[model samples]
Target: MKRIPLLSTAFIFLWFSTTAQDTLTLSRGQCEAIFLRENLSLIAGQLNIPMAEAEVKQASLWPNPQFTLDEINLWATRHQTGGKEVSPPIIGNWGRNQQYAVSLEQLIYTAGKRKKLMALQGVGVEKAQQYFNDLLRNLKLELRRQITELQYLQLSEQTFQTQLQSVNDLLSAYERQLEKGNIAAMQVTRLQSKQFELQKELHELKQQNNETQKELKQLLHLPPQTFLKLSSEQFERALTDETIPTYQALVSKASTNRPDYQLALLEKSYFEKSYFYERALRTPDITVNGRYDRNGSTMLNFVGFGASIDLPLFNKNQGNIRKAELGIQQAKMLSQQVLHNVETEVAASYKSLLNAHAFQKGIDPKYLQRLDHSLDAHTRNFLSKNINMLEYLDFLESYQQNKLSILDAARDLNNAVEEVNYASGTELIP
Candidate 1:
């Protein structure tokens, strides 16, 4: 063999390690960690927490103080030398020519407006937190669903391949029988046609398997060409024999643990705080002013302080306060709506789980195993001229179809349980 570059060999080894590490023979906890660390949307959702915290900080800060300076002239005068009487003084000569003044005024109170604003900010932070948690839960559920689907598809593909091989063997036997004049030409042609159909179906399943892998990779945010293989035993153990919670218990759990409901409650509180803050606007804010003046001629300085407060005489913020009150009402309505939706979803998902479980129970593994053996016997009999080609093909097709259906049913049951867990805010996986 030609010498492989040292760098190339190292790269190959590194690639294998990286890909293998990413393969993730995932447990429920491992799936949760991957979502927390790698899922882009969930990571982006975390930024909202800091953003809301900044808003709270902003709400707690006081307003900047205002400053003012003034100058007065004290030695300027105009003289009129005419036959008419002169004015006493054209300009003031007793006031300061220049003055420097600075004053700091802090808001004394705003009738609990600041406290209300801070409360609203707290609600915002809570809402952000709830949203992030909800996103994490939803992403994990979807990932589980896809993983389960891929497992089912892989199993189905194997079943189809095995069936295809058996059919090929039977077809070969039939051709040999035709050569020996033990079978009609038409019978051999029919067997060939059936084998062709099975091959076509096998090809389709392979294509589907490829597509499923691509989807799984996309969900995991891994490179498209990554060589990932799931451990079937691990997957089966993850979902097998799960004990579902009671409906009442699930509803209670959702009320406490579901993030969307918590978010709605936070929003209602935020709007209520806003209402109170707006109502506090009915009280006017006070502005205090202080000034100092100096005269150039006598170097005299004057200082004075005064307070100014706006009268709510013209506008008393009636419209804005009314709007805020309405907002509180709206938030309450929305909270009710969210509660109803959660209850409905929990009921529906639980029902689905029950139906899927029933279907799974209805399937008899022993009966299927016996039927599979029978189909194999029939196939062999057809090859040995004890049965016809048509009967062999029919038995093979039926056996494969039944096996595929069983696999699909099993997968559906797993997905339904995941759905129930997700809707009820239960940690079924981890």
Candidate 2:
């Protein structure tokens, strides 16, 4: 019978939407597993390996043989005297329509060209495999990063909701007191305005959470309705010790362990092989042919074999050989560049981990709890006229901000550790 106000209806709708989303209960390992099993990009990248292998098999096959029919002759003659013409024609005894021979030829050799081609195809397969490995590493790291971000956002949103609820309750009490003429209408209006601001903040946080959830769903290759609830406790446990490898150690580990750098090394080797294979192509190719002939009338048979070869006088494949050599040089340069980048990344991530560790150590949970209790006491005192409203509000604001900062710092530390592990090409867990 009663209708809700527009703002109230809107708030209800927002709340229901936020709560109705599916929740995935996942740890970090579970998150990584889901991406490995489900992410479409990784799946597609994996398919490239088989595709390249098929190419290698195709390249290894020899060329098909060629078949030829040599000659078939038909004769026609007009005779002045039929008898004389027939006798002349009969001189080529038993002249059936003449048929000569059939021949077949297969390429015998290509001066190691087939070997070079197969080598090139083998390089292609190696490159594809290395690329797949690189993709796998990047995909796992991205999944971990996204899950961490979502967990942090959820925590932030929950804290904001709690603060908003507290503010709303206080505003409702103020409204009641104002109706009884025990509080000024201006005071009630100020409290109501604060409540509205908190609601706005809560709405913004929820929107951010929704966006992150959508990204996680996409990463997991799940439908939009799929729920994701992360294990915050597990994350907290993961951040317990905060001990990390030194910068030099991290660099060394990354150089040895990072798949991207290893892939680059493999690519360089492939190019080196390609350059040599191209140089080997300067040799000429030889082709051999064979044929057989038979005449049933005389019971005579003959066999013959012949060969041909390319001189390589004009085109020595000089341009292709030079290009392949240049490619080798370029690959080496790129390998060096990637090594430098990996070292720099490892150092940077190590520093970030150290800083995060120090920042987290500076946070005291008990101190925050005490401050929360004090802020609550101050609010009660303000209601009883023992303290001013400004002091009470300031204390509440400071307490809430401190709580948020601590949670944020914790999440940052966890993320920093993840970064260190990612850079060093290792797992943070275990």
Residue 342, candidate 2: C-alpha displacement in angstroms: 1.4
Over 126-225, each residue of candidate 2 has an lDDT whose tens digit, in order, gives 7787788778777676777778777877777776676676667778788888889997888877777777777787788778778888888888776687
Q: Each model's TM-score, in the order given? A: 0.80, 0.83
Model 2 misplaced stretches (Cα beyond 4 Å): 1-23, 70-95, 110-112, 240-242, 293-302, 371-376, 428-430
Query: Candidate 1's residue-wise lDDT over 1-430, tens digit each?
Result: 1222322454345446655454534434444444455556765678889999999999898787776544433233343224332223325742223334445455545688777888888889998889988987888788888778767767777787777777788778778878999878998788778778877887887787788778666666666656556656433333333566678988999888899999888888877887888888888887776766443223345566788788899899999888888888888999999999999999999898888877877787586688668877887787677977667777877888798788877888878878888988876434
lDDT of 1 at 289: 67
Question: What is the lDDT, from 0 to 100, of the residue 346 in candidate 1?
Answer: 94
lDDT, residue 55, candidate 1: 96
